[model samples]
Target: MPDYGFERIGKRLFAEHLVGGNFGNMSVRDGDAGFFIKKTGAYLDAPGEPVFVPFEGPVPKDASSEYRVHLAVYRTTPYRAIVHAHPPYAVAASLVTDEIRPLDSEGEMFCPTIPVTTGAPGTQGLANAVAEEMRHNKLVIARGHGTFAAGATLDEAFLLTSLAEHACKVIALKKMFLQ
Candidate 1:
């Protein structure tokens, strides 16, 4: 039932190009046991079915490659949902700064400052870096990759992804033609 939210979020992500191909993953806490994650290689726009993964033992073989990243955040934070996406503008911003300072009003209020991390995707180093940043920031950009965002719900997490990208777009635009 809760996984339905991911379906909607996924579709939106695809439509807005927040994620393309099989480049993103999402999950929602399903109690203390574990959480429900999108299947590996599943398209966010229309992920066919959900996979319920537990916290105790080994991760399912079919789970997304970034499952470790999602688990790490849930283990250390109160956030119940996570969204990982390769937003073009955000990734571009990461190449230029350690922190993304929001230019838009909504972005300034919601995202404020987004930290950037560097590491190979699905590595503990990357996961730990993201979890560490989540201590004070809900959204963090993984340099040369994308964003790792967490929130009370999938929609909230998704909003951070969108906001980060939008803010980065503004920054990029200003630096380009506006300058």
Candidate 2:
């Protein structure tokens, strides 16, 4: 379809280790047919060709298991881009707390408090939880799972994901030092 900034976002996510192997997913709304989502099992840092599926039609065989989450966000929110990843530190931090209170200044400003979602990774419950939080904030952490960030553009969504990871690192580091 169109150059939806997937390549750049993929590379950045991979380089930052926000995702590994075939983990995580990214998607962009394509006018009205539906959305262009990374194919199932494709590496987030290099999801070759995108698979565009109609919102009300059958999903392709290669679509991500969490494609439902992407669709839910597009249907309920105005955001056009979504980035889902299991940023190591962010996911780790979520395991210990329901909400990650960003201790760093940037975290405080951009992610004062990152909310966590509970449920199986690719379930509708998980999607609904993430979509609800996304209405108020651009990023959310799926407890013991990963992070889901959305924005008008892929760049904004990617940045929110990165910022969330950085904040998690700060929180983790501080905890380590204090203990």
Candidate 3:
């Protein structure tokens, strides 16, 4: 069965232009078992066919390498959903700083101070990095990767991701003016 909440999350991500092509993933917790994440290689456009792998045991073999990041956030925070994306401005901001400090209310509200995680794909190292950073805030940058946001529901997660991207874009434009 299709998880309607997740499908809506995917659609919202697409609407925000946070996801382009097949780049990005989102997940929602599955009660006590774990979480259900989008399958590897699934794009936002094909929400109906999106994979919903259960994370009951270890991360599923076909789970997105970024799944560890989601697991880490959910484990460390009260978050029930996560949205990770390569939003151009946010990814650009991540690459520019080893740390991202919120320069506006949007950032202050959802992220405040964001940490940059370390590790190769699918490794616990990145998860640990995110976990440590998330102890202080709900958002973190994945170094060369992308941005991640977690919340109590898919809508909240998606909203935070959108806010983060918007904040990043505004910050980038402000920097341009300063230059």
Candidate 4:
């Protein structure tokens, strides 16, 4: 019933250039057992395979490096899916600002204010920071790293991921050409 469209969303992430090579990850909660996450080193376009991780236990050796962030979100938020990516514009904007207030309409309505937080990449600290904000925001940016977005389904999460990038792109462009 839940849209576990990992492969479909993965392809879109790749086709749209939101991710390049093996730069991002995705996951879906697997009831009380655990969650299924994209494997480390796997390409978003193909998404080699998904690794299952329990709510409490040793993680799979091949799980995505950002697995902790995904796990934390699943445990702390009501969202059922997550999509993480290093979209260029969003990552670039995050470098200079502590928060991103979308200059565009859709970003204004859907996201509006996305908090930018920081922690070393692939650590529990980063996971905690991201999960904490995701509880109150649709998406959170990790300083100069990437984005962590959650939704009831992968489709919804994927859309947020794209929206963040588009909105950030607008901000970046306007700042470059208009400001």
Clashing pairs in 2: 40-62
User: What TM-score, over all chains together, does every model reach?
Assistant: 0.96, 0.96, 0.86, 0.95
Quick one: how many clashes does candidate 1 have? 0
Q: Model 3: runs farther than 4 Å from truth?
A: 1-4, 49-59
Model 1, 49-102: lDDT tens digits are 778888889888999988888888889999999999999999988998899998
Ranking by lDDT: 4, 2, 1, 3
The number of residue pairs in model 2 that clash at the backbone is: 1
Off by over 4 Å in 1: none
Q: Which stretches of candidate 4 lie over 4 Å from their true place?
A: 1-3
Clashing pairs in model 1? none
Model 4, 1-179: lDDT tens digits are 34478789999998888999889999999898789998998987773568899999899999999999999888888888999998999999999999999989999999999999999999999999999998898799999999998998989999999999999888878878975
Model 1 vs. true fold: TM: 0.96
Q: After superposition, how far is residue 76 of candidate 1 from its true place, in Å?
A: 0.4
lDDT of 3 by residue, 1-179 (tens): 54548767777888888888878888887676677777877785564444445545555666776787777777777778788887878778877787777688877776776776766656789788876777676677777777777778777877877877888887888889999
TM-score pick, better of 3 and 4: 4
Clashes of each: 0, 1, 0, 0
Instruction: Score candidate 2 by lDDT.
Output: 0.89
Local distance difference test values of all predictions, in order:
0.89, 0.89, 0.74, 0.90
